[model samples]
Target chain A: MFGTGQFQLYNPVRVIYGKGELKRSAEIFGVSNVLVICDPYVSSNEYFKEVMTGFNSVFIYNKIIPNPPCELIDEIIESVYEHSKGAPKFEGVIGIGGGSTLDTAKAVSSLLVSEGKLADYVEGKKKFEKRLPLMLIPTTSGTGSEVTNVGVYTLNDIKKPMTSPTFWADIALVDPVLTYSMPKRVAATTGLDALTHAIESYWATSTQPYTEGLALRSAKMIFESYEASLNGEEWAKDEMAIAATIAGIAFSQTRTTAAHAISFPITSFYNVEHGLACALTLPTLIHWTYKFISEKMDDFVRYVGFKDVEELAKRIEHMMEYSGFSLKLHDYGVKEDELEKIAKVSVEANIINLTPGNPKYEDVLEILKTIY
Target chain B: MFGTGQFQLYNPVRVIYGKGELKRSAEIFGVSNVLVICDPYVSSNEYFKEVMTGFNSVFIYNKIIPNPPCELIDEIIESVYEHSKGAPKFEGVIGIGGGSTLDTAKAVSSLLVSEGKLADYVEGKKKFEKRLPLMLIPTTSGTGSEVTNVGVYTLNDIKKPMTSPTFWADIALVDPVLTYSMPKRVAATTGLDALTHAIESYWATSTQPYTEGLALRSAKMIFESYEASLNGEEWAKDEMAIAATIAGIAFSQTRTTAAHAISFPITSFYNVEHGLACALTLPTLIHWTYKFISEKMDDFVRYVGFKDVEELAKRIEHMMEYSGFSLKLHDYGVKEDELEKIAKVSVEANIINLTPGNPKYEDVLEILKTIY
Candidate 1:
């Protein structure tokens, strides 16, 4: 029941959430040649194809890579332009996959109407003039990219993820049916990612009462349901899916902080799954910063159904181990030689400022070393 | 801690909440000549006048009456049309006062652009095509009319609160400073009204996860702050104000049930204040329907910081007596001869169908008898 002095919070997207909601996509997006952007893995699923049968003039752009690359975005834009024959086209862009695919869709939608390159819209200098009617359908329950105003893109040469506020999706369809198909590992990873988003947003310096309520609720849901979801329980899976979406909305209002800042570089450099990378750093980050943000940490731990902060970190570690996720960077093929570059790259990344406690360069190096 | 089935919940209204937010109205409303709607009682307040000074070309329409009569609405509309000269029309309608004034503003705004009378929009058959941009500023921490989509008006010799799915204000400016001038009775009555809205909405047949979360939080706030607010504690006043606004949004989505339905007749016939009537019937209504909606009742008691249902009811009774508000109809000058007419009118109200527990005619009579 914390008070937010004064703030403006609004997400104007109409969310249609249900098992068969995907079938009504055409009704929601009327009389337009649709560009459906999806992960190749998800686009290949038979169920996704079955849902696509209801729509007309649909173009499937399924080349979205995990930690989406700019080249793939260029390819998508060129394909849309080539297919449309110079007419003001693509009535809508429907993204169907994990956060990466959704990010790609957001980027394409944002870049379609703007005159500049994708880099111009990265991290606050968002000059997005117009966005094609956008709809995001998340496959995994984590990374609530569907309802967020952020899109994380990988710089091919630098190997770092860049984010911007201009990347808000017009519609975020969170259907639990999409999550049931995810393998246990994917669920575990994405679930952890959602948890990290909630945790970071809850403790972020810029957080308000509105965002904190959603973040706290989301963290609680993830902790309560993550184990059962990983154990293949149907009810828990549904809850996790909803929790992830809620977390996305929460973090969307207040972008992720310390853990996310550290995790991004690890993912870019080591190719660890985004959620797992964040999860690995979260326990360590919380342990280090607990003294600075102790009250908030205590609230988070209790909210997530833990006795204390230590137990909460242990619970996260236990879940990661049970889900077959690697906690140490070494397990993910990070050599001793790569540590310095990884640390330096992380410091240079723009997310470093999001760390409220202002961890020094040595602090960042120590956290990376502990995880390594 | 509760699981909401797949649902999307986000309110996009820019909420400026605090002590001095009212003074920022000119900035929020931009350069529009503001059309301020308020109860005649509030128009005379020095604080109201001070706040109104910030707006340019301010037009004060203080004809709003209790239960918001349709004749008053017609007069306001005529005034707006005649004064605006068909150019530089009201950029927005700012509602400043209790639920009546706020509800009147909602109704007027909805009708400003439409081609028909107010009655045409009754019961979802809205023919009011266009609406002036609208903002609601509530002076009481009850009714929650500022953040809700329903408006109650006494029309055709009957009091009914009609709801429209599309009727929502662009901004709901909730400032606790405005509530400081409320008398102890006003505070107690309105606070009870807010509590009733929360409790009834939580037990509503259409209650979903989003509404439950908000209702639970609002109920807790009311329980903790209502007495303190009545005692003239500034901090409690702010919290209760926010709680009422949140509860309003919660119940607005899932309309009120038995208590609200039954309370309307008492206000209409006996001339009881809306909040006082709502408070008088709440305890009896809860006791009567507890068996039917026991789960919700238990939840309500716990959330409202009561040890049990009986305790919650006793607390309400104590508060009513302390505030000098009458709990029995006889205290309010309702003679024995008028009971049958009040009962008949209460039974005839269309809202009887919305009672979640679906009380029988005998049950309604029994509830009235208990209050009597």
Candidate 2:
């Protein structure tokens, strides 16, 4: 039986998706005064020149680190104030990079209207009353942050996410041409990250019929074409781009279940890439989550062209290994004793309860040991 | 290759869906001065009493007939004026029945401010400047009319659909409990109607990845459980309700293609029920459309658990026959010579161009003859 649940969907973000739809950015973003947020790598690239063409005034903030810290956003907030001294007021923000860039853009948009820093609002000390409009052009396919209404930033030395409908972008230009420059290794890990989102969300306790449709299609697209995407098939890049955004829509409604809940501490403590950290635990998590709901597990395997859940997990592991995502816990500078602490931290995360039934601390510890 | 296309999704409708979500209608619609739209059968039901509970001024307009004509809508327009003589102006419209009732409600919402008649807006002579807030509680599983932005009404003696973004409902409270009392004959035809929507929309030339995901899942659900839903299975009723709504969303994005194009004349001329008319020719249309795109056909058959396109078509025919949807054109009072006009009129619909390739008038004629 399809579970009875109330799906509250209110995505007001307009999306313009195609191979070369970025030319319409000026029309979609409206006014000319805008802040362009990205990393130093993206600002140094050639496409940045085209992106800066339409705006009358553009403030560049390129200090975002991976798993972006709140202090970096505080610095950018200072930079925006510095640039606004003798110019027209900033009307919007344009984010054009990976997850951290988009997240920082969203955070900066929210902070401009609210009091204090980003942490104050995130920690419940303040609530934002309004926000600057946002438009995102993603250079990477992994984060799905362009469409989702959350920003993942490092807070108090651990990666924390702030969620509210105010963070959704007004326009997301998902041009596949922007993703061609992503490194092969980045492509693999991010593709796996999207795959994990689709799979974990398919069986989440709160998974509804609408999200199920998206999760199924995402799983089919990523599983069929991710390896080819790693090898740089042009069409596969487009499919992967669309698949990642679709997976984001799937999990954004239900939130991620087990694998995502378990990945935060690994990325924070060991400095593993966010997508890679999520990718590492996904195969084992799939094996574990399938034991709770066998029917859905069977459907997943059948739809993705596998005979059983074990085959599906092994396929994911093979894809990860082929793409250079195979590193032991020790490779990330984790000692043997650190595994238990990591497991405990993952269990304490609020998203852990979003999974089906009660996945005890003991269960997470076992899964960690197996992955290690 | 996944065809390069833009997925412009911006659904701002707040959907509160569950088993008993109709109780929150007062909160969602906001003001108490509301108009109730339904059929005679639905207005006499016990749930109609519950729908009228929290309204200070409520006007009931239950004169909507099947294959709804603009003349009847003109009468509804007059009745609404008749009721507004001494009461506070109706601030909102609450549509609580099948497709005709919901379409009438949406049409009334659009007509509140527009000059002249409904046909003027449909024919591009006038446009709706604003609409009354609409809250829809669907009592049938077919016609994804609740979430869509178009109202199908007969204009100038031909069934015409008025298209606009302004027609989308503010709130769609999809409660499956309201659908359990559907008669078996209604269940069969409407279930087939939804299945056709899913299948036809999947192959539309403008179909995007997101709508394809919704269409595929909807097709799977309706095809799998429609037979059981005809037998009055409780779980099947719930599945059909969700599937039909999902199909509505799928077709709403791209609109329906050739089968829907062909079915309109049958519905308007032969006096066949709207759903049943679409159901009549769907199987043969599936067989014909499959010959054009065999790879997608293979995927559709495999995913829906059929051996081939022919097997899928046969399975559809079997389901229709069991649901009492089998009848010849002659049985509906169409002479053999009328077949040419029916086929010619099907070709004239704007939606026929939405099909994948050039499906000529002769192709439609052959398919109609085979189905006949």
Candidate 3:
């Protein structure tokens, strides 16, 4: 039976999706002067100039680092102040890049209007009440940061995830043309990230019918398009672009479950890419969580055309292998003895509590060691 | 292949769904003084008083009529003004009961803040830019009016459908307990209305992946729960409530297709209920549209667990027979010659153009005669 639990669904971000739709950014943002936060690689892309053509004026900041630090956000804000004489006059803020650029843009937009450092809000010392009109355009398909109300920033050498009402962008422009330039490795990891999001959101203890429907559909598309997307097929990339955003919107409501919670410690400790780190544990977690969600897992398997949960698990492992990544945690430099530490760190995440059957430290350690 | 056409998905209504969520309306609305628009039947329900227990004060207008008219809304505004001595002071507007009550409340809230008669906006003479904080509670599983931006109102003896940004309620409280009291007839018709929404939204030429996923999932639930819901099972009713809202959100983005367009004429000409009127054409149109959307319809059939589109169509016919609704329009007082007039009227609705293969007057007439 579908669970009869109470839940709320609200996503205010207007997602405009299509091929080559980036050209309409000026019309969609409906503003003139704007500040754009993007990755350095994005600024040098051949098609970048055309994307900014309709804007009357723009402030470009392309010094985005992965897992953006709070100080980096502060530095960007200070530079904006120094450039604008402390009276920044921009009608909107646009985030254009991967997760780091988009996450930084979320903080920058809120801090420009509110009084505090990014850390103040990240640390829970303050709340963001409002921000300028904000738009997020993802250059890669993996980080649904463009549509979610969540932002992750590094502070004191630890990743701190925060949610703010203002972080939900006014518009999420998903132009698949932007993702066509991703390297094959980027494609694989990010594709896996989208897949994990689909599965985790589908089975999260907080899952509702609305999110469950989205997750099922998103996962099906990812399974169909992951291989073709890595081969640089525009049609497959287009499907992946839409699928990733749909998955993002799914997790945006349910948050995520053990997969996401576990991925955090693995990424923070091993320097593995976020999506790759998440996928490393996914196959094992699929088996581990089966007893708790057997019928639901069966439904997911059937809807996505897998024979069973085992095949679903093996397909993900196959995707990882095809992408040239070893499935074992030891291959990523994790010592077998360090499994307990990863488990300890994973359980510390608040979201891990949302996992079905509520896997404990020992359970997590067992799953980690199974993969190692 | 999934189409790469452009689309925008934005639903700002916070849908709070649970078995007994109606009691928390006060906390969710976060307002003291409120204007309530409800049906006369609702005010007499045994649980009505409990729903209002947490409110500071409530001004209830319960003389709601089916197919609410423009004069009735103007009268509601006049009564509020007369009661408050020229200035109407309400922190929010709460709409309870069926579609008519909810649709009336949407207009009352917007006209109170923006200005002019409801007709002024319905006739496209003016626009509504804002409304009081609005909350909608569905007492039936059909209509899905609570979550959608579209509202139908009668003006000058014609049903006019209008959409505005302000009509999106701040909250949609879908408490299945509120639907527990629906009569068997209401359950069957409303269930059919929801099923039609799911199917039409899935096959509409304007369909996108986001809505297709929702439509598929919702149709599955409706198929599973419709018969049991008619038997007054609470679990089935709970599923129906969620299914209906999901279908509403699906059509809210895609705006529906031929079945809905055909429905408007049938609903207006005959005194049949809106849901039944919509479903009368559904099975016939399902077969008629199959050639144009064969693969997509196959996908829908497979996902919803039907053998084929023909089997899907037969299931709807079986549902009508079980509900005691006649399969022929002649039984509803439409003369054989009137089929032409109904067809002429059906084609007049612009939404018919959104149908796959774009059925014309002759095509609609054929489908109507087939159903008869």
Kindly list the per-residue Cα lDDT of model 1 for residues A113-164, writing each as its tens digit: 7766676566446567678888888899898888877676756554434544
Fraction of true A-B contacts recovered by candidate 3? 0.57
Top DockQ: which candidate number?
3
- CA displacement after TM-score superposition, residue B371 of candidate 2 (Å): 1.4
How far off is residue A191 in model 2, in Å? 1.5
DockQ for candidate 2, please give it: 0.55
Models sorted by DockQ, best on top: 3, 2, 1
lDDT by residue for model 1 (B1-372), tens: 344354556455556676787878878767558788887788888778665656767888887777767767877787888887874377788889998888899888877777667776774565555577888889999988877777877778666667654457888888788899998878888888988888877777766555665676677667777777888888889888888887886776677777776677787676777778877888887677688767666755654556778998888788788787778888888887677667676677665666666776777777777777
Q: Which residue pairs of candidate 2 clash?
A: none
User: Which 10 consecutive residues of model 2 chain B have the lowest summed lDDT?
Assistant: B1-10
lDDT of 3 by residue, A1-372 (tens): 562777889999999998888888999899999999988899998767856878999999989989889999999889999999978998999989899889999999999998878999999999999999999999888889998999999999888889999999999999999898999999888999999999999999988888888998899889988998898888899999999999999999998878888888888888899899999989998998899999888878877888999999999999999999999999999998888899999999989988889999999998888889
Write the residue-wise lDDT of candidate 2 on A1-372 in tens digits. Answer: 572555665566676788877766777688788888898999988767878776788778887778788888888887778777743288988899988899888988878766688888777677776789899888887778888888888888877787877888888788888888888988987887888788877888878777887898888889878888889887888999998888888787788877887888897788777678887887777777776888777866776678888998888888888887674667678788888999999998887887876587999988888878
Candidate 3: residue B42 lDDT (0-100): 96
Compare candidates 2 and 3 on TM-score and give the better one: 3
Two-chain complex of model 3, DockQ on C-alpha atoms against the true structure = 0.68
Q: Candidate 2: list runs displaced more than 4 Å.
A: A3-6, A55-57, A74-78, A86-88, A114-116, B67-91, B113-117
Candidates 1 and 3, the one with greater lDDT: 3
- Report the CA-based lDDT of candidate 3 relative to the real structure: 0.90
Give candidate 1's error at residue B34 in angstroms.
3.0
Query: Who is ahead in lDDT, 1 or 2?
Result: 2
Per residue, candidate 3 scores C-alpha lDDT tens digits across B301-327 of: 877778898899899989999999998
